[model samples]
Target: MQTSSQLKRLGLFDARVPRYTSYPTAPHFKPGIGAELLPDWIRAIPENEAVSLYVHIPFCRRLCWFCACRTQGTATAEPVAAYLDSLKQELATIKGLLAPGIKIEHLHWGGGTPTLLQPDMITDLTHSILNAVPLADAAQFSVEIDPSEIDEARLDALAAAGMNRASIGVQDFDPMIQEVIGRPQSYEITKQAVDGLRARGINSLNMDILYGLPHQNTARIIDSVEKLISLGPDRVALFGYAHVPWVARRQTLIPTEALPSAEERLGLYYTARDLFLAAGYDEIGIDHFALPSDGLAKAHKAGTMKRNFQGYTEDVSKVMIGVGASSIARYPQGYAQNEPATSKYQAAARDGRLAGAKGHVFTDEDIARGRVIEELLCYFRVDFSKLADELSRPIEYFFTMVDGLELAMPGTTDLSGTVLSIRPEARPVARMIARHFDDYEMNESGHSQAV
Candidate 1:
C-alpha cells in the first residue's frame, strides 16, 4: 500500500537523513576533537566495567560496487599484513591507558572482509587483543563474514579465538543483480560458509539482504529472502540499498537508470517483511529481523535495544572502543574515530599514539536530545516524562520539535501528554521524524534516502 502518491506525501524522496546510528552522526564530527581525546576517554572508563571493542579490518580482495564502507583492495598479503601490524601497535597504545584488569563484554570484527586474514594472522590478532584487554568469561565475540573469502581454516581459527556470532552478507541471490553490483555469491557458496561456521560451533548467525537494488522486484526479493530463510540464520538484516554515489564512489559504477524507484523500493521491502514475519521472525527496528528466541528480539521487547555505528545492537556497554583504521568508538563523553586511510593509521600507530582523526564532544543538550531520538528509534515511542526525570529537565525541554513536526507532517506524529510516538502508518519515516530534534546542523542532501 506504500504507493507513489503516499510516498510523495510522506517525503519518501526527501533528501536522505542520517541513520541516527549515533547522535550527532559521524558527518557532524569535527577535527577539534581528535587523537588527544582518545587516551582520556579510554582512561575514564570506570574500573572493571565491561566494554565493547570494534576492530576494523579495512582490507578486501575485491571492491564491491555498492559498498560505502571505508576499505581498500589489495592484490597481495603485504598490505593486509602491514595493516595488522599497525593494528597491533594501536592496540598496545590503548592497552597502556586501560585500567588494570579491565574486561571486554563484546568484541566485533567488521570488514572489509575480516576473513581476508590468514588463519595464523587471525590467531595472532586474537592473542594481541586478548593480551591487551582480556575478555570476560561470558563476553561475546562476533565477526562479519564474506562467503567467497572465508573457508574451513579461517572458520576454525575464528572459532578457536572465541567468535560466537557471525554476520554473513548475502545482498541478493539474483545472479543478474549480483553481476551488476559486482558482488556475486551463489547460494551454494553462502551455504558452505554457513555450514563451515556452524561446524565450528558458532551458534549465532546473522545474514544481510538488500532491497532497492538495480533490478530487484517483489519476485526477486521474495526469492532471495526465501533462500536466506532456508539457511536458518538466527538473525536477518533486510537493508534498503542507499545509492549515494557522491559519498560512496564505488556506487558510481552502478547505473542510475537501473535503480528502483522509491515506490518500487517500498514494495520490495514490504514483500520481504511479510515473508519474514510469516516465517516467525520478529521485526527488530526498521531493517532487522530476528527469531523469537534471538537476543535482539528479546532486547526490543524488554525496551533495551540500542542503535550504534553498527546499526541496532543488543550490546549496551556505555563505552565501545574502536580499533584499526576507520573504526568509531563510543564513550560516555563522546565519540572518537581512528584515521580513515591505512597509511595514516599505520603511521600514527607506529608512532605509539591513538590514530584518532575526528570526533564529536557531546553537550548537555546534545545528550538529552540524543536520548529522545534513541528511545524513539528503538521503541517507536518515547515517554517524555520519564526522559525528563532522567535528565532532570522540564518535559518541553526534551521535545522542542514535536509540535513543529506535527505541524509539518500532520497525523504523522502523535503528542498526547508526555508520550511521543510516530503514527502506525508513519513508522517507516521514524528516522525522518527523529531528525527534527537534531540541533546539530546537517545537510540532508548528503544523506541516504529515508526509505
Candidate 2:
C-alpha cells in the first residue's frame, strides 16, 4: 500500500482543480462574446431537437462560509420578488427566440436555492417556463431545495410546478462542522424535510455531503455516512468543499490552517467510498453515489451516463437551455452563460435580449476531445483505438500527448493501454489523469479541489 507521504508527492491532496464538470471549465468563459450574436445562435438550434433546461436562483436565506456558488443572502423578500420579475421577462425573451413546441427532455433548478422563491413565484415561474418550452412526455423535472427553506406552502408549490425530484443540502450534521461552515441546519430538521417531501409523493431525493472541510476527519465522515444512510436518500453527492477565498469571499472566514492535509483528504475520500459501498450504494462517478436501482446507476451500467454543469446526470439531451442569472446553456454548437451579476442579468433580459456573457463555440476538435475526456472521467478508462478511428487520426498521434505527460508521471505510460486506464484505486486522481487530454493547459487556475 502507498503511504500518505508517497501519495502527497503524487499530488493526491493538491489545491483545487476543475471538477471536470466541463472540459473547458466555466473559468475559461471569456467576455466580449456578448448577446451581439445571440439571435443567430439561438435561431441556429436545430428544429425538433429535445433540449434540457437549467434555471438559477441567485438568492439564499443565509450564506455558508464554504459555499462557492453564485448567491446572495437577503434580509427581506423584496429583492427576491424583484429578481423573479427579471426571470419572467427573461423567459419571455427566450420564448420568442425558441422554436415553438420544442421538446424539453430535462429541466433543473439549481442554487442559490430554488426553494427560496415564494410559493406564488414558484408556481408562476414553472408555469411560464413550461408554456414557453413545453416539456416532453418523458421530461425529468428536478430542483435543489434547502430544507429550512421548504414549508408546506413551498412543498405544495413545488409539486404543483411539476417538480418530480429534489436535491437537499446537508453538508454536515455535526454542530461543530456546521458552525465552522456557517450553515446550521440540524439533523432533525433535515430528516423532517425529507419525510415531508416524501409524504407528499416526491420520493426521488438526493442529499449533499462534503469532505475536506475544516475539522472534518475519517471518524466524522464515517458517522455522517451512517446518518445519511438512515435518511435513505435515493442519491448522495459527496462533494469536496472547494475553498477559494480569493474568488468566493465568504470562504475567507474559514481558517486556512484548520483544513486537512492532502493525504488526509485522500484518506477521507477512500473512507467515504468504502462506507457507502458497504452500505450497498453504487459509486456513480468521482463523487456521486446512488442505490443500484437509481437511474444514474442504471445509466452508468448502460454506458449512457452524461456529465454536465450539474455533475453527473441521466439527462442526455443534446441541447441545454439555461434561464435566470448566471445560468449556462449548452447547445450542439457551443456553451453560453447569463451575466453573473443579478442587476446585469435583469437589465439584459428587461431590454429583451439573451443574457449571454461569454462562452466557447465548440470546434470539431473540442467535441472530439470533450468526448474522450468525459468518457475517461466517467468510466476511468477510454478506448484510444476507437477514438482514433472515429477522429480519423492514427492512435500513435494521440499518444504524443501521453508522451508529453509521461515526463511528469512516468507510471501513467506503463499503466495505460490500447484502452487507457488508471488503477481502480486511483479514481480520485482521475481528474489529474484526464488533464492529459485537455487541449488547453493554460486554463488550469479555475479548477476546484481534487478530493
Candidate 3:
C-alpha cells in the first residue's frame, strides 16, 4: 500500500511519456533528412561487417483497432503483389549501394502481417533480400507470424528460406477481449500456429501478450498468461496496451469506459509479471521474459541487450537497415525512416531512389543523451563514468542533465557517485524518469500512460 501510494504520489498513473524506443522519439522526427542523404549513409557501411535488416510488410487482411502501426487492410492480393514488387525494387536499390562483403547478422520481417504473403511471395521476397545482402553464418532470421493468416505451405516456404525465429502476437486469449479489440485470434488458432512452427523444427519463438486492454482484469490476464505459458514460447513480451484513440483513430471503436484505470492497469501488469517469473522465465528488461537458454536471456545476463523499434533485442550490430515503407533504419550517423505511405515509397523505389522521408541526425549531445536513456531503460541504471569513457567525455558531462533527477522522481531513483539507478520498486516509473533526460519538447497526448 505504501509503495502504491508512492507510485500515485509520483504521478505514475497520470503521466504519459514516450516509450523511449528511440531517444528523441519518432514524433519529434523532423523533415529534410530524406532520400538525398541515403546513398552516403549506405556507402559508409564498412565492408565485411554484419548489419541488421528489417523488412516491413504493411498489408493486413484486417486492421486491429488497438494498433497504431502504419498499416492498411487489403482483401485482394493485387495490392500486396504490387507492394512486393516495389519492395524488391527497394532491395535492388539497396544492393546497388552496398560495398562487397557486407552481410546481414539479424533479419526481421515485421508487419501488418508478414504471413499475409502467399507461399511463393514469401520465397521470392526472401530471395530478393538474401540476394541483396547474403545472411552471415549463424544469422538470425525472424518473422512476425499472424496466426490467423499463416498455414503449412507458408511455414514450409519460411523454413526453406532459413527463418529460425518466429514472433507471434497473442494479445489475449479471452473471447470477449478479442472481440472488443478487433483482433479475433483464438487460443486454439494460436496453438495451431505454434504446433506448426515446432513441427517444422522452428522451436525458437517470441510471443507478445498485452495488459491494460479493455475489459482486462486480474483473473482475465491470469487465464491468458497461463494459456500463453502452455504454448511455451522461448521469449515473451508482456506489453501494456497503449490506448491512444486520438492517435490510432480506429481505437475509438473500443469503449473508453471498458478500459482499465491507470492503477488497475499497473496491477494487471504485476499480476501477469508474477506469473512469468513463477514459471521459470528470466525477466529481460522491462516487459520481456526469456528462458535461461534463449539469446535474449543470455544478452540480458551478459549486459549486451539493446532496445530498438522492435523493443528489447539481443542484436548488437551497429547498423540496422530497414526496407519497405514506414521502416526506420539505424546507422551510426543517425536514424532514417522510409516514406511511410506505401504508394509514395513504391514510386520512389521504382524510380531508383531511396525512400527515406524523415530522420534525425545525431548530434554529439543527442548521442550522449540517447546512450544515457538506452542504458537506463535497458539496465535500469546508468554508469556515468563508464559512459564517459566510452563516449570520450568527462564524468561531469552528464551531471547537468541528471541533476535533480531524484527530486523530480521523488525517492524512485538513487544517484550515487555519478551513477543513477532506478530502484527495483520504482521500475514501473522508468519511462517517467527517462523523461527528465529528454532534451526535446513532448506533447503528452502523443504518448501512452507512464505505467
Candidate 4:
C-alpha cells in the first residue's frame, strides 16, 4: 500500500467538493419549493410501490465537538417530549397526503442520538408511524443509537416497537481521540449495547467510525477499528472527518493545526478500507462495508444498492419521506427539507403545517443527470447508451458531455460502447465525474471534501 505522503506526492487528493449525497447538495436548497408542491408530489406516488422513511431526532445528551449534524444538546426531557409531539403531528400530516393505506419498505431513525428519546417516547413514535403508514411484511425498521443513552429496558422497548436494525455511533475507541472529539465511549459499553440489542431480537447492526479527526492518525484509527470489528457489527460506515469550522461553530474547538494533512487523510481512508476488506468485508460504496451475507453486500452483488439521504441502502424506492425536524423528503420532482430548529418545527406542526423550509425542484434535465450520477456513484459505471435508449435518444448526443469530462480528467475517463467508467485509480475522483451531470450552480456555500 502507498503511504499517505506518497499518494500526496502523486497529487491523488487535492480537490474539496460535495460527497454527492444529493446531486444538488443540501446547500443549494432554497426556500422556493414548499407546502403547496408537496401534496401533488405525494399524490403522484404509485399506490402499489413501497417507499422508505427516515425520522430525524435532533437531540443529544452531550454535543460532540467534531459533530456537524443538525442537533441540539439537552439535559432534560421537556424539549424532547415537545419534539415528539411535533413529530407525531408531522406524521399525521404526511399520512393525510399519501394515498390510503400506503406500504412502507424501510424506516430509519437518525440523529444526534435517537436513544436520547425516552423509551416510552420511542414506542409512542413507532406506534404513530405504523398506524399511519402500514409497514410491509419485510419492512426493515432501524435506528442510530448512542451507547451511553441506552439500557437493557430501552433496548427491549425498541425491539418490541419493531426495530430490527441498530447502528451504534462508535466514532473511535481511542481514549485521546475520544476526549478530543468529546464523545467518549468504552469498548465494553459499546459491546454491551450491541449485546443488549441482539438479546432483544434486534440482530442487524452497523458501527459507524470516523477518521481524520483532530488527533486521529493511522495507529490510533486502526486501534479503534480493531476494537469495533471485534464486537462484530454486520456493517460499518467509515467516514472521513469533514473539518468545516466555518459552518459548525463547535468545530473550532478542534485545533486545526493538529488535523491531519490532505495526504494523510487519504492514507487514513485507504488504510481503513484495506483493514475492513482484509477482515472479509466487501466495500459497498465509497465508505460503507458489509459482510458478504449482509443485505448491503448482497444488494451490491445484485446491482441493486442505492444511495440516499441516509447514505448507501438496499431500499430501492424512488421516493423517501422524511419526518421530524431537519428531515428531508425526496420526490421524483425534487427534495424538500423540514425546518432544522426544534422550536420552529414544533410551532409549524402545531399550526397544522408541513414544516417545509427550503428545497430545490429538479428540472427534467436535473432528474436525468441525477439518475446518471446515481448510477455512476453507486455502481461506478453508467451505461449512457442504455440511459439514452430509455430516453429514446442517440448516444452521439451525450458524446459532447463525455468530451467535457475527458478534458477535465484527461486519461482518467474511459468510454467503451455506451458505458462510461471512472478508472479504479480515479475512484477518489468519483464526485468529479458525477459533477458533470450537476446542472446546479457550484459555489463554496454547498459542499464537503470530494474524497
Candidate 5:
C-alpha cells in the first residue's frame, strides 16, 4: 500500500487522464466525418459475421446528482413512445445499408433506466430491433434495471425478449450517501428486483456500486458490498465516483468537501477489493470483480476480455452498433456518435438517416496504436511483438514510443521479450501509461483524475 505522500509523488490525486474507453477517447471527435465516414464503416462489415448492438434509453424518472451520463428526467411515457418509434426508424435505415446475413451476437439496453418502458413499449422495441437484425442463436441479451422503476410487467417484457443477463445499479446502500447523491433506494427493493429477474429466469446478474460518495466511510462501503454479495450477482462493477461537475451540471449539487480524500478513496477501493477477493471473486482489470464461474472470468483467463463504454465487457464482435441518443458506435474504421439531444436523434431517425453528429476516422497508425493501448489497459501488460505482427508494423516502432510511455508514468514500465507491462504496484497508473500510445492531443479539461 502506498502512503499519501507516495501517492502524491506519483501524481495519483492531481493528474488528469482519459479512461481509454475508446482509444482517441470521445473528446477528440469532430464534425464532417459523420456524413462521410460512418456509412463507409457500416458498409464495410465483414461478410456473414455476427455484430453487437447497444441501444441507449435516455429517459429517467429521477436525476442522480453524481451521474454524468446523457439523460433527462421525464414525468410521463409520451416521450418514451416517441423515442421508441424513432429508434425503430433508425434501425430500419441501418438495415437498408448494412450487408446481408449479419446477425446480432450480443444486444445490450443501457439507460437512464431501461425498465422505465412499459411492457408494450419494451415488446415493440425488441421486436423492431430483431426485425432489422436478428439475434444469433447464441446471442447474449442484457439490460440495465432500476429497482425503483421495474415491476412485473416491465420484467415480463424483458424476459419475453430473451434477456438472459441483467445489470442492476445500486450506487451505495448507505442512506446518507444515497440522500446526498439524490438516488435513495432501499436494500429490500433492490433484492426484490433481483429476485424478480431470477424468477424470470435471468441466469446472470451484474450489480454496479460506487465508492468515494459523500459520507462513504470504509464501514458503509463494506456493508453495501456485504449486502450485494448476499444477492449472488455473477459480476460486480465497483467504480470510483468521477466528480465531473463541469460536464454534468447536476453534480454541482453534491457537497464536494464531503467527499473522501484521495488516500481515503484508495482505502475505500482496497476495502471493497479485499472483501470481494476473500469471497472468491477474481478481480477483472482495474475495477470489476467476478466469480470464478462467470463468463467475464473466463474471458479474462483466456485474455479476450475488452474494455468499452460499459466498462469491462466480454463482447468480441468487430462491429458495435450503438442506436440511441448520445450512443457511440464502434467500427473497424472509426467511431461515430449519435446526436446527444433527444429531439435531434428523433428527427434524424425519422428522416431515414443515422443520428450521427460527430465522429473520428481512424488512420492506420491510430488503429495500430489503439490495439496496443487496448491490450495494455485490459491486461496490465501487452505482448508488443504479437501486436506489432498483427498490425504489420515493425517491432522497433514501439521502441521509439517508449520515451512517451515513461513520461506518462515514470519508472513503471518494463520491457522483457517484447512484453510491455506496468509494474504490479503501479497498476492504478495504467491509464496514464496507456496514454503513451495515443496519437491525439491531450484535452486536460475533458478527463477525470488518474486514479
Candidate 6:
C-alpha cells in the first residue's frame, strides 16, 4: 500500500469523488428529459429482451440520520397502501410501452425498508409486478430487508413471491455507534432475520456494513465485522459513510466532531478489509467482498461484474427500469428518473402517465468515456485495444485520453501498449484516478471522500 505521505500528496486524504455507479452521476441529470421522452425510451427496447427492474419503497418507520436516500417516515399504513397503488399503476403504464415477450431478469426492491410492507402488500405488489411483466427463467429477485422490521409472515410472503436473494443492512453491531447514528438494531434481531430467510431457503444473502461512522474505531469495526461474519452472508458491502449534512438534513443530527478523520477512515476500511480477506472472502470491486461460491465472486473471476445504482452486480441487461418515487432507470439511449416527490409521482402514475422528471441523454462521447470509467473501476485496469475495437474507434483515440493520467499521479499507473492499469498499492486512490477521465465538472461537496 502507498505510504500515508505519498497518498496524502496524491490527494487521497482530502479528495471527494463520485462512486461512479453511473457514467454521469445523478447530479448531472437535468430537467426536460421527463415524462414526454420516457415512453420512447421504453418502447425502444427490443421484443423478447430480458431487463432489470428496480422498485423503490421510500417510506421508513424511522429515518436513520446517516442515510441520504430519498425517504420519509410514516407512522401509519394508510400512506404505504396508497403508495403501493401508485407503484402498481406505474408498472401497468410501463407494461403498455414494453414490447411483447419482454421478461424481467433481475428485480430489486430497495429502501427505505421494503420489509415494511405487510404480508398482503408484499404478495399484492409481487402479483402486480408479474402481471405486468413476467420473471424470466432463473430470474433473481432481491429485497433490502431491515431486521428491526421483518417477521415470519413477511418472509413467507416474499418466498412465496419467488424472492431468491435477500440483502440486510447491518450498519454496525456496536450499540453506541448505532445510537449515535439513530439506527438502533441489535445483532440478535439481525441473526433472527437471517435465520428466518435461511429457513425459507433464501440462502443467497447480501449484507451491508458501514466503515466510517460517528466515533468508529478500528476495535469497534473489528467487532462489528466479526459479528457480521458469524451470520454467514454470501456477500458483503463495506461502504464508507458519507456525511453530507448540507444535502441530507438529518445528518446534521450526528456529531461532526466525533467523526473520524480521512486517514483514520482509511485505516478503518483496511482493518475490515483484512478481516474479510482472512475469512476467505474474495474482494469484489473497491468495497465489496463475496464468498467463492457467490455469484459476485464468480462474476469477478469471469470478468462479467458490473456496477449500477445498487453497486456491483453480475446482471448484464442493457435496460433497467426503475418504478416508484425517486427511482431512476437506465436505457440504451440514456437515463430517466422518476418524480422525486411522492405526491407528484403518485398523481402522475394514477393518471396513467410516466412519472419521469429528470435524466440525461447519452452522447457518443458520454458512452465512450463511461465505458473507460466503468472498466477502470471494476477491473482496476482498462483494455484500450478491446475498447477501441468494441467502440469502433482507433487505439490512438484512447491513448489521447491518458496523456496526463500517469504524470498526474506518478508511479501509480502503468500504460504499456494498449492497457492502462492502476498499481495495486495505488488502488486506494482508484476513484481519484478514474476522475482523470471524467469530462463533467463536479461540485466537490456533492461527493464523498476519495479514500
> On residues 1-451, what C-alpha lDDT tens digit does candidate 3 reach at each position?
2366677666565425678888688877778786868789999999998999999999999999989888999999999999999999999999999999999999999998999999999999999999999999999999999999999999999999999999999999999999999999999999999999999999999999999899999999999999999999999999888887778899999998999887788899999999999999998777899999999999998999999988999999999999999999999988899999999999998999999999989899999989999999899999999999999998888987776565566677888887889889889878788887887843353322232
All candidates' lDDT scores? 0.87, 0.81, 0.89, 0.81, 0.86, 0.91
TM-score of each: 0.96, 0.94, 0.96, 0.93, 0.96, 0.96
**What's the TM for model 4?**
0.93
Indicate whether candidate 1 or candidate 3 has the larger lDDT.
3
Candidate with maximal lDDT: 6
lDDT of 3: 0.89
Residue 66, candidate 6: how far off, in angstroms?
0.7
Instruction: Give RMSD (Å) of candidate 3 vs. truth.
Output: 2.6
- The segments of candidate 5 whose C-alpha lies over 4 angstroms from its true place after superposition are 9-15, 442-451
Model 6 TM-score on a 0 to 1 scale: 0.96
lDDT of 6 by residue, 160-189 (tens): 999999999999999999999999999999
Model 5 lDDT tens row, 1-451: 4465665566554425677789788999998777567777888897688999999999999998999999999999999999999999999988888888999999999988899999999999999999989999979999999999999988888999899999999999988889999999999999999999999889699999998888899899999999999999999998888888988999999999999988898889889999999999998887899999999999999999988888888988888999999999998878999999999999888988888999888888788778888888789888878987888889888766665555555577888888888887778767766766676743453222242
Q: List the residue pairs that clash in candidate 4.
A: none
Give me the overall lDDT of model 4. Answer: 0.81
How many backbone collisions does model 2 have? 7
Residue 278 displacement (Å), model 6? 0.6
The residue-by-residue lDDT of candidate 4 on 39-136, one tens digit each, is: 68888887777988888989989999989888888999998998889888988887887886578899999997899877899889889988778789
Which regions of candidate 3 deviate over 4 angstroms?
1-16, 442-451
Candidate 2 structure, TM-score to reference: 0.94
Misplaced by over 4 Å in model 2 are: 389-394, 412-417, 442-451
